[model samples]
Target: MKLRTLLIAALLAMPAAVTHAAEPIEGNWKTASGATAAIAKCGGGFCITLKTGKHAGKRIGQMNGAGTDYSGSITDPETDKTYSGSGTVTGSSLRMKGCVLAVLCKSQTWTRL
Candidate 1:
Protein backbone atom coordinates (compact mmCIF):
# COMPACT_ATOMS: atom_id res chain seq x y z
CA MET A 1 0.00 0.00 0.00
CA LYS A 2 2.77 2.45 0.86
CA LEU A 3 4.70 1.53 -2.28
CA ARG A 4 1.64 2.10 -4.42
CA THR A 5 1.09 5.49 -2.87
CA LEU A 6 4.70 6.44 -3.50
CA LEU A 7 4.43 5.33 -7.12
CA ILE A 8 1.33 7.45 -7.66
CA ALA A 9 3.00 10.46 -6.08
CA ALA A 10 6.00 10.07 -8.30
CA LEU A 11 3.85 9.86 -11.37
CA LEU A 12 2.02 13.03 -10.42
CA ALA A 13 5.25 14.91 -9.97
CA MET A 14 6.44 14.07 -13.47
CA PRO A 15 3.82 16.17 -15.18
CA ALA A 16 4.71 19.23 -13.17
CA ALA A 17 8.37 18.77 -13.94
CA VAL A 18 7.68 18.52 -17.67
CA THR A 19 5.52 21.60 -17.63
CA HIS A 20 8.36 23.62 -16.09
CA ALA A 21 10.51 23.37 -19.15
CA ALA A 22 11.99 26.59 -20.46
CA GLU A 23 9.80 28.79 -22.61
CA PRO A 24 10.35 29.27 -26.36
CA ILE A 25 11.61 32.85 -26.16
CA GLU A 26 15.26 31.94 -25.59
CA GLY A 27 16.42 32.62 -29.11
CA ASN A 28 16.89 35.11 -31.89
CA TRP A 29 14.05 36.50 -33.99
CA LYS A 30 13.45 38.67 -37.01
CA THR A 31 10.99 41.50 -37.02
CA ALA A 32 8.84 42.41 -39.99
CA SER A 33 10.86 45.49 -40.80
CA GLY A 34 14.12 43.71 -41.62
CA ALA A 35 15.40 44.14 -38.09
CA THR A 36 16.59 41.65 -35.50
CA ALA A 37 15.04 40.81 -32.13
CA ALA A 38 16.92 38.94 -29.47
CA ILE A 39 14.69 37.33 -26.88
CA ALA A 40 15.60 35.84 -23.52
CA LYS A 41 14.25 35.22 -20.07
CA CYS A 42 13.80 38.26 -17.88
CA GLY A 43 12.29 38.74 -14.41
CA GLY A 44 10.77 35.26 -14.58
CA GLY A 45 9.18 36.30 -17.85
CA PHE A 46 10.51 37.13 -21.31
CA CYS A 47 11.95 40.21 -23.00
CA ILE A 48 12.74 41.05 -26.63
CA THR A 49 15.19 43.68 -27.82
CA LEU A 50 16.21 45.19 -31.09
CA LYS A 51 19.57 43.80 -32.20
CA THR A 52 19.95 45.87 -35.30
CA GLY A 53 18.15 48.72 -37.04
CA LYS A 54 17.82 52.47 -37.10
CA HIS A 55 15.28 54.66 -35.39
CA ALA A 56 15.59 58.38 -36.08
CA GLY A 57 19.06 57.69 -37.45
CA LYS A 58 20.16 56.31 -34.08
CA ARG A 59 21.01 52.68 -33.57
CA ILE A 60 17.91 51.21 -32.03
CA GLY A 61 18.41 48.91 -29.10
CA GLN A 62 16.66 47.81 -25.99
CA MET A 63 15.83 50.62 -23.64
CA ASN A 64 17.30 48.74 -20.71
CA GLY A 65 20.11 47.20 -22.70
CA ALA A 66 20.63 43.44 -22.93
CA GLY A 67 19.33 40.99 -20.32
CA THR A 68 17.15 43.50 -18.53
CA ASP A 69 13.75 42.86 -17.07
CA TYR A 70 10.88 44.19 -19.15
CA SER A 71 7.66 45.49 -17.76
CA GLY A 72 5.11 47.85 -19.28
CA SER A 73 5.49 49.61 -22.60
CA ILE A 74 7.78 48.55 -25.43
CA THR A 75 8.53 50.39 -28.62
CA ASP A 76 8.14 48.85 -32.03
CA PRO A 77 10.76 50.01 -34.46
CA GLU A 78 8.67 49.32 -37.50
CA THR A 79 5.73 51.44 -36.46
CA ASP A 80 7.73 53.81 -34.26
CA LYS A 81 5.19 53.58 -31.47
CA THR A 82 5.12 52.45 -27.88
CA TYR A 83 2.77 49.59 -27.06
CA SER A 84 1.63 48.29 -23.72
CA GLY A 85 1.24 44.53 -23.35
CA SER A 86 2.94 41.21 -22.86
CA GLY A 87 4.02 38.22 -24.95
CA THR A 88 3.97 34.46 -25.05
CA VAL A 89 6.21 31.90 -26.70
CA THR A 90 4.47 29.27 -28.81
CA GLY A 91 6.21 26.75 -31.04
CA SER A 92 9.15 28.73 -32.31
CA SER A 93 7.15 31.92 -32.42
CA LEU A 94 6.74 34.77 -29.98
CA ARG A 95 3.39 36.46 -30.40
CA MET A 96 3.23 39.96 -28.93
CA LYS A 97 0.32 42.31 -28.99
CA GLY A 98 -0.15 45.59 -27.22
CA CYS A 99 -2.54 48.47 -26.89
CA VAL A 100 -1.88 52.14 -27.14
CA LEU A 101 -4.00 54.10 -24.71
CA ALA A 102 -6.70 51.43 -24.23
CA VAL A 103 -6.97 50.75 -27.92
CA LEU A 104 -5.92 47.53 -29.62
CA CYS A 105 -3.21 49.26 -31.55
CA LYS A 106 -0.88 46.55 -32.86
CA SER A 107 0.21 42.96 -32.86
CA GLN A 108 3.18 41.13 -34.31
CA THR A 109 4.32 37.61 -35.08
CA TRP A 110 8.06 37.14 -34.73
CA THR A 111 9.65 34.00 -36.12
CA ARG A 112 12.69 32.29 -34.64
CA LEU A 113 15.87 33.68 -36.06
Candidate 2:
Protein backbone atom coordinates (compact mmCIF):
# COMPACT_ATOMS: atom_id res chain seq x y z
CA MET A 1 0.00 0.00 0.00
CA LYS A 2 2.90 2.38 0.75
CA LEU A 3 4.45 1.64 -2.64
CA ARG A 4 1.13 2.30 -4.36
CA THR A 5 0.72 5.59 -2.47
CA LEU A 6 4.17 6.71 -3.50
CA LEU A 7 3.43 5.93 -7.12
CA ILE A 8 0.22 7.91 -6.93
CA ALA A 9 1.96 10.89 -5.37
CA ALA A 10 4.62 10.85 -8.05
CA LEU A 11 1.99 10.71 -10.74
CA LEU A 12 0.23 13.72 -9.26
CA ALA A 13 3.49 15.68 -9.23
CA MET A 14 4.47 14.76 -12.78
CA PRO A 15 2.53 17.61 -14.40
CA ALA A 16 4.12 20.22 -12.21
CA ALA A 17 7.60 18.89 -12.91
CA VAL A 18 7.24 18.37 -16.63
CA THR A 19 5.25 21.47 -17.51
CA HIS A 20 7.31 24.48 -18.48
CA ALA A 21 6.01 27.94 -17.83
CA ALA A 22 6.58 30.47 -20.61
CA GLU A 23 8.81 33.40 -19.91
CA PRO A 24 7.35 36.89 -19.76
CA ILE A 25 8.97 37.76 -23.08
CA GLU A 26 7.48 34.85 -24.95
CA GLY A 27 4.53 35.90 -27.08
CA ASN A 28 3.39 37.71 -30.19
CA TRP A 29 3.72 41.47 -30.00
CA LYS A 30 2.63 44.48 -31.97
CA THR A 31 5.68 46.49 -32.87
CA ALA A 32 5.85 50.27 -33.06
CA SER A 33 5.93 49.94 -36.83
CA GLY A 34 2.56 48.16 -36.56
CA ALA A 35 3.99 44.78 -37.40
CA THR A 36 3.39 41.55 -35.56
CA ALA A 37 6.50 39.97 -34.11
CA ALA A 38 6.68 36.58 -32.48
CA ILE A 39 9.18 35.89 -29.70
CA ALA A 40 9.90 32.29 -28.90
CA LYS A 41 12.60 30.05 -27.50
CA CYS A 42 15.43 29.38 -29.89
CA GLY A 43 18.54 27.57 -28.78
CA GLY A 44 20.04 29.43 -25.84
CA GLY A 45 17.81 32.47 -26.15
CA PHE A 46 14.70 33.93 -27.74
CA CYS A 47 14.33 34.80 -31.40
CA ILE A 48 12.05 37.65 -32.47
CA THR A 49 10.64 37.17 -35.92
CA LEU A 50 8.36 39.48 -37.81
CA LYS A 51 5.10 37.89 -38.83
CA THR A 52 3.41 40.66 -40.78
CA GLY A 53 4.03 43.69 -43.02
CA LYS A 54 6.84 43.82 -45.57
CA HIS A 55 9.28 42.28 -43.12
CA ALA A 56 7.27 39.13 -42.60
CA GLY A 57 9.34 36.03 -41.86
CA LYS A 58 12.35 38.17 -40.97
CA ARG A 59 14.23 37.42 -37.77
CA ILE A 60 14.98 40.90 -36.45
CA GLY A 61 15.89 40.36 -32.85
CA GLN A 62 17.56 38.01 -30.36
CA MET A 63 17.45 38.32 -26.60
CA ASN A 64 18.80 36.48 -23.57
CA GLY A 65 17.62 36.29 -20.01
CA ALA A 66 14.35 35.39 -18.35
CA GLY A 67 11.49 37.12 -16.51
CA THR A 68 11.07 40.86 -17.18
CA ASP A 69 14.50 41.90 -18.45
CA TYR A 70 16.45 40.96 -21.55
CA SER A 71 19.42 42.20 -23.59
CA GLY A 72 20.39 41.50 -27.14
CA SER A 73 20.41 42.94 -30.63
CA ILE A 74 17.60 44.38 -32.67
CA THR A 75 17.57 45.02 -36.39
CA ASP A 76 15.64 47.65 -38.24
CA PRO A 77 14.00 45.85 -41.09
CA GLU A 78 13.54 49.05 -43.02
CA THR A 79 17.17 50.10 -42.89
CA ASP A 80 18.72 46.66 -42.31
CA LYS A 81 20.76 48.15 -39.48
CA THR A 82 21.47 46.34 -36.23
CA TYR A 83 21.74 47.93 -32.83
CA SER A 84 22.36 47.01 -29.24
CA GLY A 85 18.99 46.58 -27.58
CA SER A 86 17.40 45.88 -24.25
CA GLY A 87 13.83 45.04 -23.32
CA THR A 88 11.63 45.43 -20.28
CA VAL A 89 8.36 43.61 -19.92
CA THR A 90 5.62 45.18 -17.86
CA GLY A 91 2.21 43.58 -17.70
CA SER A 92 1.09 43.19 -21.29
CA SER A 93 3.58 45.59 -22.79
CA LEU A 94 7.20 45.28 -23.76
CA ARG A 95 9.33 48.38 -24.02
CA MET A 96 12.24 47.88 -26.40
CA LYS A 97 15.15 50.23 -26.79
CA GLY A 98 17.97 50.30 -29.30
CA CYS A 99 21.13 52.35 -29.16
CA VAL A 100 23.88 53.61 -31.37
CA LEU A 101 27.22 53.84 -29.55
CA ALA A 102 25.26 53.56 -26.31
CA VAL A 103 24.64 57.29 -26.51
CA LEU A 104 21.94 57.68 -29.09
CA CYS A 105 19.01 55.54 -28.15
CA LYS A 106 15.40 55.15 -29.19
CA SER A 107 12.59 53.21 -27.57
CA GLN A 108 9.21 51.87 -28.50
CA THR A 109 6.47 50.12 -26.54
CA TRP A 110 5.11 46.95 -28.01
CA THR A 111 1.73 45.58 -27.03
CA ARG A 112 1.32 41.89 -26.43
CA LEU A 113 -0.91 40.15 -28.91
Candidate 3:
Protein backbone atom coordinates (compact mmCIF):
# COMPACT_ATOMS: atom_id res chain seq x y z
CA MET A 1 0.00 0.00 0.00
CA LYS A 2 2.89 2.38 0.83
CA LEU A 3 4.56 1.67 -2.51
CA ARG A 4 1.36 2.39 -4.42
CA THR A 5 0.84 5.62 -2.49
CA LEU A 6 4.38 6.77 -3.29
CA LEU A 7 3.93 6.02 -6.99
CA ILE A 8 0.68 7.93 -7.11
CA ALA A 9 2.25 10.86 -5.30
CA ALA A 10 5.14 10.97 -7.75
CA LEU A 11 2.84 10.86 -10.76
CA LEU A 12 0.63 13.60 -9.38
CA ALA A 13 3.61 15.88 -8.70
CA MET A 14 4.96 15.66 -12.26
CA PRO A 15 2.53 18.17 -13.75
CA ALA A 16 3.26 20.80 -11.13
CA ALA A 17 6.97 20.32 -11.67
CA VAL A 18 6.61 20.82 -15.41
CA THR A 19 4.37 23.84 -15.05
CA HIS A 20 7.06 25.71 -13.11
CA ALA A 21 9.94 24.54 -15.25
CA ALA A 22 12.37 26.80 -17.06
CA GLU A 23 12.25 27.64 -20.77
CA PRO A 24 14.56 26.02 -23.32
CA ILE A 25 16.52 29.25 -23.77
CA GLU A 26 17.47 29.36 -20.11
CA GLY A 27 21.14 28.61 -20.62
CA ASN A 28 24.36 29.85 -22.21
CA TRP A 29 24.49 30.68 -25.92
CA LYS A 30 26.85 32.21 -28.45
CA THR A 31 26.30 34.95 -30.97
CA ALA A 32 27.39 34.96 -34.59
CA SER A 33 30.36 37.23 -33.91
CA GLY A 34 31.86 34.56 -31.68
CA ALA A 35 30.61 36.39 -28.59
CA THR A 36 29.30 34.25 -25.80
CA ALA A 37 26.18 35.14 -23.83
CA ALA A 38 24.09 33.72 -21.08
CA ILE A 39 20.29 33.62 -21.07
CA ALA A 40 18.57 33.32 -17.76
CA LYS A 41 15.12 33.70 -16.27
CA CYS A 42 14.20 37.23 -15.30
CA GLY A 43 10.69 37.59 -13.96
CA GLY A 44 8.23 36.89 -16.79
CA GLY A 45 10.98 37.32 -19.37
CA PHE A 46 14.58 36.40 -20.12
CA CYS A 47 17.72 38.47 -19.65
CA ILE A 48 20.54 37.93 -22.14
CA THR A 49 24.02 39.32 -21.75
CA LEU A 50 27.34 39.07 -23.48
CA LYS A 51 29.75 37.04 -21.42
CA THR A 52 32.91 37.43 -23.55
CA GLY A 53 34.55 38.92 -26.65
CA LYS A 54 34.39 42.57 -27.73
CA HIS A 55 30.94 43.03 -26.20
CA ALA A 56 32.05 41.40 -23.03
CA GLY A 57 30.09 42.03 -19.81
CA LYS A 58 27.28 43.81 -21.61
CA ARG A 59 23.62 43.06 -21.88
CA ILE A 60 22.80 42.90 -25.56
CA GLY A 61 19.08 42.27 -25.16
CA GLN A 62 16.15 41.09 -23.13
CA MET A 63 13.36 39.02 -24.63
CA ASN A 64 9.79 38.54 -23.55
CA GLY A 65 7.97 35.52 -24.92
CA ALA A 66 7.66 31.79 -24.81
CA GLY A 67 8.85 28.81 -26.83
CA THR A 68 11.14 29.77 -29.73
CA ASP A 69 9.72 33.22 -30.53
CA TYR A 70 10.41 36.38 -28.54
CA SER A 71 9.99 40.13 -28.90
CA GLY A 72 12.13 42.68 -27.14
CA SER A 73 14.75 45.39 -27.42
CA ILE A 74 18.32 45.14 -28.63
CA THR A 75 20.79 47.74 -27.46
CA ASP A 76 23.91 48.73 -29.29
CA PRO A 77 26.42 49.71 -26.65
CA GLU A 78 28.59 51.46 -29.19
CA THR A 79 25.82 53.70 -30.50
CA ASP A 80 23.91 53.64 -27.22
CA LYS A 81 20.82 52.97 -29.28
CA THR A 82 18.03 50.66 -28.34
CA TYR A 83 15.81 49.20 -31.03
CA SER A 84 12.71 47.13 -31.23
CA GLY A 85 13.96 43.63 -31.74
CA SER A 86 12.34 40.29 -32.43
CA GLY A 87 13.99 36.92 -32.58
CA THR A 88 13.24 33.29 -33.29
CA VAL A 89 15.15 30.32 -31.96
CA THR A 90 15.23 27.17 -34.03
CA GLY A 91 17.05 24.23 -32.55
CA SER A 92 20.51 25.62 -31.72
CA SER A 93 20.07 28.69 -33.91
CA LEU A 94 18.84 32.20 -33.13
CA ARG A 95 17.92 34.87 -35.69
CA MET A 96 17.42 38.42 -34.43
CA LYS A 97 16.46 41.77 -35.94
CA GLY A 98 16.76 45.26 -34.60
CA CYS A 99 15.61 48.47 -36.26
CA VAL A 100 15.79 52.18 -35.85
CA LEU A 101 13.63 54.77 -37.68
CA ALA A 102 11.45 51.80 -38.66
CA VAL A 103 13.05 51.34 -42.08
CA LEU A 104 16.67 51.19 -41.03
CA CYS A 105 17.31 47.80 -39.56
CA LYS A 106 19.82 45.01 -39.17
CA SER A 107 19.65 41.32 -38.41
CA GLN A 108 21.96 38.47 -37.53
CA THR A 109 21.86 34.77 -36.97
CA TRP A 110 23.51 33.53 -33.77
CA THR A 111 24.60 29.99 -33.18
CA ARG A 112 24.42 28.26 -29.82
CA LEU A 113 27.83 27.74 -28.24
Candidate 4:
Protein backbone atom coordinates (compact mmCIF):
# COMPACT_ATOMS: atom_id res chain seq x y z
CA MET A 1 0.00 0.00 0.00
CA LYS A 2 2.80 2.41 0.80
CA LEU A 3 4.56 1.57 -2.45
CA ARG A 4 1.36 2.15 -4.41
CA THR A 5 0.86 5.51 -2.73
CA LEU A 6 4.43 6.51 -3.54
CA LEU A 7 3.95 5.55 -7.17
CA ILE A 8 0.79 7.61 -7.46
CA ALA A 9 2.44 10.57 -5.85
CA ALA A 10 5.35 10.41 -8.27
CA LEU A 11 2.99 10.22 -11.21
CA LEU A 12 1.06 13.22 -10.03
CA ALA A 13 4.24 15.21 -9.66
CA MET A 14 5.56 14.45 -13.11
CA PRO A 15 3.51 17.07 -14.97
CA ALA A 16 4.55 19.83 -12.65
CA ALA A 17 8.17 18.82 -13.05
CA VAL A 18 7.85 18.93 -16.82
CA THR A 19 6.21 22.34 -16.76
CA HIS A 20 8.94 23.70 -14.55
CA ALA A 21 11.57 22.27 -16.86
CA ALA A 22 10.27 24.37 -19.76
CA GLU A 23 12.91 26.70 -21.13
CA PRO A 24 12.72 30.42 -20.38
CA ILE A 25 13.26 33.20 -22.92
CA GLU A 26 16.17 35.11 -21.52
CA GLY A 27 18.67 36.10 -24.14
CA ASN A 28 19.55 38.40 -27.04
CA TRP A 29 17.71 38.26 -30.34
CA LYS A 30 17.95 40.05 -33.64
CA THR A 31 14.99 42.00 -34.90
CA ALA A 32 13.90 42.13 -38.51
CA SER A 33 15.88 45.34 -38.87
CA GLY A 34 19.04 43.53 -37.84
CA ALA A 35 18.87 45.21 -34.47
CA THR A 36 19.60 43.22 -31.34
CA ALA A 37 16.97 43.06 -28.60
CA ALA A 38 17.30 41.63 -25.16
CA ILE A 39 14.49 39.30 -24.11
CA ALA A 40 13.76 38.15 -20.61
CA LYS A 41 11.13 36.19 -18.76
CA CYS A 42 8.37 38.21 -17.11
CA GLY A 43 4.86 37.60 -15.74
CA GLY A 44 5.00 33.95 -16.75
CA GLY A 45 5.96 34.97 -20.29
CA PHE A 46 8.78 36.97 -21.91
CA CYS A 47 9.49 40.55 -22.96
CA ILE A 48 11.91 42.68 -24.97
CA THR A 49 13.63 45.10 -22.66
CA LEU A 50 16.32 46.62 -24.81
CA LYS A 51 17.11 47.21 -28.44
CA THR A 52 19.87 48.49 -30.66
CA GLY A 53 19.33 52.06 -31.76
CA LYS A 54 21.14 55.22 -32.84
CA HIS A 55 22.16 55.59 -29.22
CA ALA A 56 23.65 52.16 -29.29
CA GLY A 57 26.54 53.16 -27.07
CA LYS A 58 24.38 55.29 -24.77
CA ARG A 59 22.42 53.90 -21.83
CA ILE A 60 18.75 53.78 -22.78
CA GLY A 61 15.91 53.06 -20.42
CA GLN A 62 14.22 49.70 -20.34
CA MET A 63 11.59 48.91 -22.94
CA ASN A 64 8.19 49.01 -21.25
CA GLY A 65 7.06 45.73 -22.66
CA ALA A 66 4.77 42.85 -21.76
CA GLY A 67 3.69 39.56 -23.26
CA THR A 68 1.16 36.79 -22.83
CA ASP A 69 1.27 34.21 -20.10
CA TYR A 70 2.98 31.77 -22.44
CA SER A 71 4.05 34.04 -25.28
CA GLY A 72 5.85 37.30 -26.05
CA SER A 73 5.92 40.29 -28.36
CA ILE A 74 8.25 41.96 -30.86
CA THR A 75 7.47 45.66 -30.82
CA ASP A 76 8.07 48.19 -33.55
CA PRO A 77 10.22 50.88 -32.05
CA GLU A 78 9.23 53.43 -34.61
CA THR A 79 5.52 53.03 -33.98
CA ASP A 80 5.70 52.63 -30.24
CA LYS A 81 3.01 50.02 -30.48
CA THR A 82 2.95 46.36 -29.52
CA TYR A 83 0.93 43.60 -31.05
CA SER A 84 -0.59 40.77 -29.11
CA GLY A 85 1.88 37.93 -29.14
CA SER A 86 3.38 34.74 -27.81
CA GLY A 87 6.63 32.84 -28.16
CA THR A 88 8.04 29.34 -28.02
CA VAL A 89 11.60 28.20 -27.58
CA THR A 90 12.54 25.69 -30.25
CA GLY A 91 16.11 24.50 -30.59
CA SER A 92 18.12 27.70 -31.10
CA SER A 93 15.15 29.82 -32.15
CA LEU A 94 12.56 31.85 -30.30
CA ARG A 95 9.44 31.83 -32.43
CA MET A 96 7.17 34.78 -31.68
CA LYS A 97 4.05 36.42 -33.07
CA GLY A 98 1.79 39.43 -32.63
CA CYS A 99 -1.63 40.40 -33.91
CA VAL A 100 -1.88 43.66 -35.77
CA LEU A 101 -4.82 45.97 -35.32
CA ALA A 102 -7.70 43.98 -36.87
CA VAL A 103 -5.28 41.74 -38.66
CA LEU A 104 -3.58 38.41 -38.17
CA CYS A 105 0.11 39.06 -38.07
CA LYS A 106 2.30 36.14 -38.92
CA SER A 107 4.79 34.64 -36.56
CA GLN A 108 8.08 36.51 -36.27
CA THR A 109 10.84 34.03 -35.67
CA TRP A 110 14.04 35.14 -33.99
CA THR A 111 17.25 33.22 -33.61
CA ARG A 112 18.82 33.05 -30.21
CA LEU A 113 22.07 34.89 -29.71
Best by TM-score: 2
Task: Compare candidates 1 and 3 on TM-score and give the better one.
Answer: 3
Which lDDT value does model 2 have at 62?
Answer: 99
Candidate 1 stretches greater than 4 Å from native: 1-21, 55-72, 78-81
For model 3 the TM-score comes to 0.84
Model 2, 5-93: lDDT tens per residue? 99999999989976788999999999998999999999999999999999899999999988899999999999999999999999999
Question: Cα deviation in Å at residue 105, candidate 3?
Answer: 2.5
- Lowest summed lDDT window (length 10), candidate 4: 59-68
Clashes by residue pair, model 2: none
**Model 2 regions lying over 4 Å from their true place:** 1-11, 14-19
Which pairs of residues have clashing backbones in candidate 3?
none
Model 2 worst lDDT window (10 residues):
14-23
* Higher-ranked by lDDT: 2 or 3: 2
Q: What TM-score against the true fold does each predicted structure earn?
A: 0.55, 0.86, 0.84, 0.55
- The predicted structure with the larger TM-score, 1 or 2, is 2
State candidate 4's TM-score.
Answer: 0.55
Kindly report which residue pairs in candidate 4 clash with one another. 71-86, 71-87, 72-86
Backbone collision tally, model 2: 0
Query: RMSD of candidate 1 to the true fold?
Result: 7.3
Which stretch of 10 consecutive residues in model 1 shows the poorest summed lDDT? Answer: 60-69
